[model samples]
Target: MSGNSSRRSPVERFFRMSLYVFAGLVLLQLSLALLAEIWPWLLGIGIIAGGISITVWWLRHRNTW
Candidate 1:
């Protein structure tokens, strides 16, 4: 009975799971708010990086095909 007593009940487990979900949602909302503020900069950098990557790949592989 000592081991069983140490284990959490279903209600306690459900509460813990709900708490985790709530915390994760709070964190996700905060991160999205921050991302919204910096999204344009991120989008610009992503586009430039992607363009450069494609250019480099084309230059290296253009003659292979």
Candidate 2:
């Protein structure tokens, strides 16, 4: 009766895990909502940055082939 006194029951553990998952989802939703207005700008910057990086990488590696 005392071997696992600190361990939670299976049902309690399941509910705790579910609560954590629910909280994570809520936080994700809130963050996405907050970023909704800037999402397009962020995407555009990402695309431009990615293109520039790729071009630079290609220029540096082109002579290897």
The candidate scoring highest on lDDT is 1
lDDT tens digits, residues 1-65, model 2? 79799899999999999999999999999998989979999999999999999999999899788
Top model number, TM-score: 1
Where model 1 places Cα greater than 4 Å from the true spot, the runs are: 58-65
Across 1-65, the per-residue lDDT of candidate 1 in tens digits comes to 57888999999999999999999999999999999999999999999999999999998899787
Per-candidate local distance difference test: 0.97, 0.96
Error of 2 at 25 (Å): 0.9
Task: Indicate the worst ten consecutive residues by lDDT in candidate 1.
Answer: 1-10
Q: Which pairs of residues collide in model 1?
A: none
